[model samples]
Target chain A: MLNVKDVKKDFPVLKNRDVVYLDNAATTLTPDSVIQSLKNYYQNLGTSVHRGIYQLANETTEKYERARKKVADFVGSDSPREIVFTKNCTEGINIIAYSLHHWPEMEGKILVTEMDHHSNILPWRFMANGSEKFQLEYVDVTKEGRLDLEDYKSKLSPDTVAVGVPGISNVVGTVNPIKEMTDLAHERDALVVMDGAQWLPHRKFDISEYKVDFLTFSAHKMLGPTGLGVLYGKEDLLCRMPPPFGGGEMVLKVDRRKVKWNDPPQKFEPGTPPIAQIIAFGASVDYLNELGISEVNEHVDRLAQRAVNKLSEIPYVDIYGPKEGESRGGLVSFNVEGVHPHDLATALDSLDNIAIRAGLHCAQPLHEVMELNSSARASFYVYNAPEDVDRFIDAIKEAKKILGGADER
Target chain B: MKDKPEIYNQDVVHHYQNPHNKGKLSDPDFSVTEENPKCGDRVTLQIKLDGAEISEVKFHGHGCVLSIGAASILTQMIQGLNVREALELTFDDLVENMGNPAKMRKDCASLSLNALKKALSGW
Candidate 1:
């Protein structure tokens, strides 16, 4: 079992601030080790990566590539060459949406779930502009907030070319069975894209085991720094796709009329990347490896379950997604009867300095399907404790009183 | 740094509970609905114009204390003001009238003002 006290000490904000942060799904608090790695990179050596024959340049480049290998290993990828660094998960999705037209499979229907974040949906929406390239279809979400597998099957016709799915719903906390979903998509000869922004932080992923064509996740969502995202594609698929971005050092040879792009990973990552952020991400991977992902996953799930049970006792509150003791991720989404979620969030902040996410949580289509305008979400991570859940629940009850009673509506 | 309780004082609660001019005009000159897309709070303002003078105003929507209260306050303020004067109503004026809310919730205080401005944009 992970020690919450020891884990809390590693987070500087937790040590310094009088707050209970339950917004880990948006971004996790950075550990000191990760911060130290970033400081070490800038303090010791600040130089451009890649081939520069000088000693410092070569050293920095080695560390940069080493970070890539560490991330590749953490995600169970076969080779670091499959990983391409981008701005964030959104940019990674865009890179594939823009580049995958090079393949013959690009000209068909695109399937995406209603539970996916806007980051996964908008890029494909922008790409499939007029149905000339691909027409977009949505796999329905059941009333209980799980992905409708029957709907997914009906949509998985031979015309389906790409399927973008999330490993976990940010709003609903439903852990999608991507392996099963991917296998079904594969049977139809469609490429599967997994948005792992929520899953990568909480669970251990083996790319070879799941066999997704591509995966994207944000470093900031984990204990790592921002301005860096990982896009992992199969070696063969990445080489076949073109790079949507172009700049210095992306090409082996470029003249006025012709350009010979670099290999798979290099071809996708054009221009100067976030060198320090990626290096610090290696430290984050090391921190997680030491703690063990399964333990972290279990700890987070327990907190979510605890929160659900506590909130369910209140007659006025209604929760989304699975019930207590069911399979869900680290977040609990809910709404109070008379109090708006925004008001609840503000009241919680004022009462106990608690931080929780409110609003659409970037899954508006899911909200529409559920017939809700917005909802409040409380997410947990390694540093959070059971006391945090008690405070969160007590604060919500107090917030209801302060905002006005449940019968006000 | 704000006393959040002060933002939801008796006046705000009263207006939120018993909002004035919160209905649709059966035959209105111009009507506009504005939404805070981030939070899904909406405000719809209906107006019946008597030439350049504001004849009647009504609003209805679902919102929190700040939004619904501000909408009620705004409808009461613009009942007889000219089109130009109604268009010139600001969020600061709402904040001043509501005792004082957090500057962070200026969007909440301004949702109805945004609707009023959009309703009279042609004028």
Candidate 2:
């Protein structure tokens, strides 16, 4: 069992007000350890890596590479050379889509799920509209808001070049069966890309266990600093794919007539990276390791289940995602009848200073399937507690009285 | 607005629920639809011109309270006003009629007015 009190103390923002932050699906609060590591890097050694041979540069390079190794070990990768740093999860996915167009013999079909965020959808849309002319297909989501395995099985074929799906739905918090999906895709020789942005912070993940070709996630969503993301690929796949961007540090040798590319990880990283944030991200991994990802997952799941039960007690409120007692991540997306999500969010904020996300949650297509313009989402993390869920439920009742006056509860 | 929820005052909520002139105008002289893609707030404003006056004005769409309330308030404000007078109305006029919205909701408050302006400009 994890202690919510200890985790809350690590985040200074939690003390700023009587506010209940239920927007962890968007971005998590950074802990003091991550913040202190950031300060230590900039205050003590403010220098670039892989450029200088001096003690400072060598130390910085070692720390940076050590962070990469930490991330690799955290994800259970065979080698640290497989992890490439990027701006955010969006950039990591874009790199794969960018390189896919140039694969000479690869087919043009790409299968994606409707439950994916826009970042996962748009990159492939660009490929289809651009010169690559890739045929993009969507796997239908079941009525329960989970991916339809039947639709996915039919969609997977020899022509399908890649399959991109989120490990967990950001809106409904449905934890998809990624390993089975990956195995099915591999049977047809199709590569699987898992959007681990919402998965890494909530559960235990091992890259080799899932056998995914590419995994992308953002640090900010996992209690780390922003402007840092990870793209972990199988060594053979990374070596086979072309570099997405070319600039300093990515090339071994440059010539007017010929150019020699660097190794897999370095070949993808162009220009100076976010060195400070990466080091802080290492601290965040350490924080998670100390608490244990399985315990964190259990804590959040307990909170989410309690929230779902309390919110479902209100007759006027409609919750989306998994059924009661089903396994889901630490989030609940819902809406009150006859009340717009924005109005409900504003009402909740005013009543109890509760913070929640009230929008499409970037899965507009999923909302379209749900037949709603928008919905409000309340997501929990390590720091959130059952008391917070109680407050959220009370605030929802207040919103119902204020906004959904015409609806009966 | 910071300490309290001034955005959805009683007046705004009342106007949102019991909006005036809230259906399609029959045989409308002009019509326009606008959607704020951010939150999927959409509104369509229709007008029936009686000579130089806007004899009838109605709106049909879905949006948040601010946009819907502003549309209702705008329709009531310009129902009997002349076409020239309605065209001269600014976004400030809309804000004055409805309470000032938050910085993020400025677009929601002005969406109906912008659509109305576009409808008249295209005329």
| Candidate of highest lDDT | 1
lDDT of 1 by residue, A268-322 (tens): 8878789899899989999999999999999998999999999999999999999
lDDT of 2 by residue, B1-83 (tens): 13444537677888888888899977988889998766788999998888888888899898888889899999988988887
The Cα RMSD of model 1 versus the native structure comes to 1.8
TM-score of each: 0.97, 0.96
Candidate whose TM-score is highest: 1
After superposition, candidate 1 runs with Cα above 4 Å error: A102-105, B1-7
State model 2's lDDT.
Answer: 0.88
DockQ of each: 0.45, 0.42
Q: What C-alpha lDDT do the candidate models reach, one value each?
A: 0.89, 0.88
Cα DockQ of the candidate 2 complex: 0.42
* The 10-residue segment with the lowest total lDDT in model 2 chain A: A400-409
TM-score of chain A of 2: 0.98
